[model samples]
Target: MFDIPQLDLKGKVSDAEWQTRVDLAACYRLVAMHGWDDLIYTHISARIPDSEHLLINAFGLAFDEITASNLVKIDFQGNIIDENCPFEINPAGFTIHSAIHEVRHDAMCVLHLHTNETIAVASLEQGLLPLSQYAMFALASMSYHEYEGLAVNPAEKLRLQQDLGMKNFMLLRNHGGLTVGKTIGDAFMHMYDLTRACQIQLQIQGSGQPAVLVDQEIVDGIRAQANIVHTGLTGGQKSWPAMLRKVYRTDPHFAR
Candidate 1:
């Protein structure tokens, strides 16, 4: 078995919530390793599995450095309940994440990022085109939101929620990408596939050559296939545990 290094997150959260924190923390690290994490600005959140509130990264920690015990727990109002750490949580990021968690009853985890490819693709007038197999699934259920500065205004939440309407994937125009899932596994998987799809599209576009696109009818079929509801809700149960094991090998504190 592969072992992961442990990074200490000083706190005393429960076992289940701690597990969520660990997986989310690993997501931050893995995203950084994949070049998807953008400094400390973007955020990833999980809905504490059974709670209405969310578990999100503290604003100051680099994605690669976050650990479970360090994750901040806050209500929908953004009030922090776990206070062992002094890091600030991003209010704007929460506004975006909270809106989704509030409306999307099925969503358990929400991951947001401003990766270069995601932003570049979002900026394009065409958006994420169906040039790859992954794109077919990505574009099928994706929503687009026109940029409105830094997403700081409370009024924008309404439009953001409206734009996201029923779709699990969103492209923040001129901004970046956001994915929601009923579980960390699902959201992460969506992001993993979606990010790679965007990277592939952007790379192909840079070639300045026309690329073949997928058929719309087929694209819809793929969405139906990818829908995890028909599947099971333990989104990251299989692979994420493996990732946790990897992270734990180096240091076991992620479960703290």
Candidate 2:
């Protein structure tokens, strides 16, 4: 009988925002379970409702090992709210995530992963080619940012934002992949799509098979379809808490 520290969410957060955190956190663990986590390197963030702050995982914690209580409340400047989780914020993580949060108000959740395929694809001279329907959606909505070492410098934020304008997705050249969604579900879904697209692109590149980039018309159509994503992740309307339940099944310390 292990006791998990579940967030009551009865008063602190609007019902929607609390659930977004839970689902966004779940998506983090799911990323780990799917072998997408790089120890403490990558990050997932969910914008706090009625506020400019976001719920981000404490730096140094592995994604799968993250829990709701372990999450940190950080403002756009990376100033952490005085809370229970004892850890320093990853300035670089905040630098990258906060930039998106400031501009993409629609982005309720943001996910950035350094999956191997993503890194390989990022390093490629030709980034994210439109080969499949997924690629079409990706290339249509995705933006590109050149890497300037670890994303800590404030100077890089404007450039990063410039590259990520309006699109909500980006391939950080020579780095990895990033996705911002109106909901945690949408962000997670976008990550899955971009990750798969990168994998296929890398595999195709390896095979030296000529990738049949989808037609421009089809690419535009795919973008239109992607726009239609009904993000159930709308502030944890039904996601984060459910995933937390799964974490509880494993161990409840995360909520503490």
Q: Judged by lDDT, which candidate is best? A: 1
Candidate 1: C-alpha RMSD to true structure equals 4.6
Error of 1 at 207 (Å): 1.7
Q: Residue 179 deviation, candidate 1, in Å?
A: 0.4
* Per-residue error (Å), model 1, residue 138: 0.9
Model 2 lDDT per residue over 19-59, tens place: 65667667777787789999888889998777887888777
Query: Considering summed lDDT, which 10 consecutive residues are worst modelled in model 1?
Result: 1-10
The digit string of per-residue lDDT tens for model 1 on 1-256 reads 4333343544455667776777787777777767788787899998886687688887877776777867788999888975544666898898899988888888888889998878999999989998998787678779999999987888888898899999988999999999987678778878877899998998898899988888788888875675464374343554576766676776554456
TM-score of 2: 0.85
Candidate lDDT values, in order: 0.80, 0.77
For model 1, the superposed segments whose C-alpha errors exceed 4 Å read 1-12, 83-85, 226-238, 249-252
